[model samples]
Target: MAGDKAVSTVSKPVMRGLLNSSIKRNLTVALTLAAISGVAFKQLVGNERKRKYAEFYRNYDAEKEFEEMRKKGLFQSC
Candidate 1:
């Protein structure tokens, strides 16, 4: 009976240690994947914004718009 009790007690700690190590490894992998995905998402968003900006200005006429704004009295000239 005492021998069985000792074995049970030792096994509990050993099992706990194994579980803790496994959990730590899994947590590390999860965090690493999350970080990589976050960076990838950021890059994708940045590239998309850049594409949209270029598309918007692809045929834009800045001087013509400025003249229109002046005609509309939206700009004051000194």
Candidate 2:
């Protein structure tokens, strides 16, 4: 009686199709986004500039200001 049972093979064509389409869709979306962001960065975002505000200290008159403050008796220990 055990020899009367029928056996069938299982095929996975649906899974293969789904995985192939998903990879293609994801790759296309990523490439499109990267291209758009690259164009925006190069054309719309422009260049970057870095400057130091501490350089303003080089233009200060420290000795003259100190002499004026001393003459005006602005320093308590002077």
Candidate 3:
């Protein structure tokens, strides 16, 4: 009976330790994923902003050229 009690006690602590380690490992993985996702989101937002600025400049230049052509009478005003 004493031997059986000693075995059970040892096994309980080992099981608890395994459970704790598993929890810690899972938490670490979750945090790493969250950080990666945040960085990706930030990069996407920066790219979108750059795209918008480029489009704005392109449109602005086209409008300026159109005005200059109008002043030069290239396009007849109807």
Q: Which candidate is the best by lDDT?
A: 1
- Residue 55 error for model 1, in Å? 0.7
- How does model 2 fare in lDDT? 0.77
TM for candidate 3 is: 0.43
Best by TM-score: 1
Model 2 Cα shift for residue 31 (angstroms): 0.2
For every model shown, what is its TM-score relative to the native structure? Answer: 0.56, 0.39, 0.43
- Please report, as a residue range, the 10-residue window in candidate 2 with the lowest summed lDDT: 45-54
Model 1, 12-63: lDDT tens per residue? 4566479889999999999999999999987999789998999989989999
Query: Candidate 1: lDDT over CA atoms?
Result: 0.86
Kindly give the number of clashing pairs for every candidate.
0, 0, 0
Candidate RMSDs in Å, in order, are 5.5, 11.7, 7.7
* lDDT per residue (tens digit) for residues 1-78 in model 2: 655566656775676579889999999999999999998776654432112334556667899899999999999999
Taken over the whole model, the C-alpha lDDT of each candidate is 0.86, 0.77, 0.84
lDDT of 1 at 50: 91
Q: Give per-residue lDDT, candidate 3, residue 37.
A: 91
Which scores greater on lDDT, model 2 or model 3? 3
